[model samples]
Target: MSPRKSVADTRRTRERIIDRSVAIASVDGLEGLTIGRLATDLGMSKAGVLGHFGTKEALQLAALDGASAIFMRLVWEPAADAAPGLTRLTAVLEAWNRYLETERGAFPGGCLFTTAAVEFDARTGAVRDAVARLYRFWRRRLVAELRIAVARGELPATADPEQLAYELIGAYLALNQAIQLERDSAAPDRTRRAVARLLAAG
Candidate 1:
């Protein structure tokens, strides 16, 4: 018989399950994720999987949260740590590229939230609301960083932080989708160049 798990071991096991769920969602879309498939893939019993999450919706929400946590660690935190201003602005963009390339395998379909947002934008309720919140938060952070850059004289005073932020985000989103469909590494590099040009123009 298997030994009983300690508290830390249980937590670790749960995290591994969530990580697997995020990977599955990235490739399959959130709707395609299921406890049975997750259990089969992870070699855990359905009861073990269901023990971690009581329902499909619960698992979806947990996956969304897990994806968000990774995004913060890989993209947001690094950018936020840079000097507030042009340095931070560039750091943010660079962090995103790094996440796409270096952390490629983490999200099989690319950006989980990006895919989920488009999938559930009009669906409404907790899941949709959570996605919407994450999107708004990211955009606001970008704008804030750009504003700092302008204030510090790294960007032109005339630059509209909100517009620039939107453009940058739109470009990244487009590139991410293209990369997923075409399986091209150049897509992310193109995004990097576009961001650099935008920053240089500011």
Candidate 2:
């Protein structure tokens, strides 16, 4: 039998593999990911990769989770620190753009959820459900922030938080896709301007 690795060593190795997987999957699409490629990139055996994730789908899910965590840290958390009003909403949009521009290699192609949703939208099962849940969660958070802005007098009292949230998310999603495909750094700046206009309108 092979000698066992210490827990810390095992964790570090697993994290390294997952990080590489995220980078590869972002550019190649989750369907293009292979254990062999991951093992080759990490200079580890295919068995080691399999031992960590057990299967490709499992690895994909783990990569999704990792991407989500990174997004929350770089995108969500920073925006959250602003005052809970139009300022906060604008901060969120700016933070998202900053994350995309600065964290280039954080995800190889772009947002993991965005990529996976396109791939799994028509499919039914756990993965699809997970993606759907994430979308709902993000939308709710945006809407809630808009509502706070309205209550705080930053937005008109009649402003519809749900509608504004939908518009912002949709716009950002479109911009994200464009930037990823075209490798345009200005896409996010355009999105920030659009978001600012929408907030001003409200």
Best by lDDT: 1
Tell me the tens digit of each residue's lDDT in model 1 across 102-182.
676779778998889888998988888888988999999889888988888889999999989889989888877778778
Q: List the residue pairs that clash in candidate 1.
A: none
- Residue 156 of candidate 2: its Cα lDDT? 92
Which 10-residue window of candidate 2 scores lowest in summed lDDT? Answer: 1-10
CA lDDT scores, all candidates in order = 0.85, 0.83
Q: Model 2 compared with the native: what TM-score?
A: 0.91
* lDDT accuracy of residue 108 in candidate 1: 75
lDDT of 2: 0.83
lDDT of 2 by residue, 1-202 (tens): 3345577788899899878877887778777789999989999999989999898888888887777788888888987778887788778888887776667687857777788889889998777887898889989989988998999898999999999999998887888777878877678778878888899898
- lDDT value for candidate 1? 0.85
The TM-score values for the models, in the order shown, are 0.91, 0.91
| Superposed model 2: Cα runs more than 4 Å off | 1-5
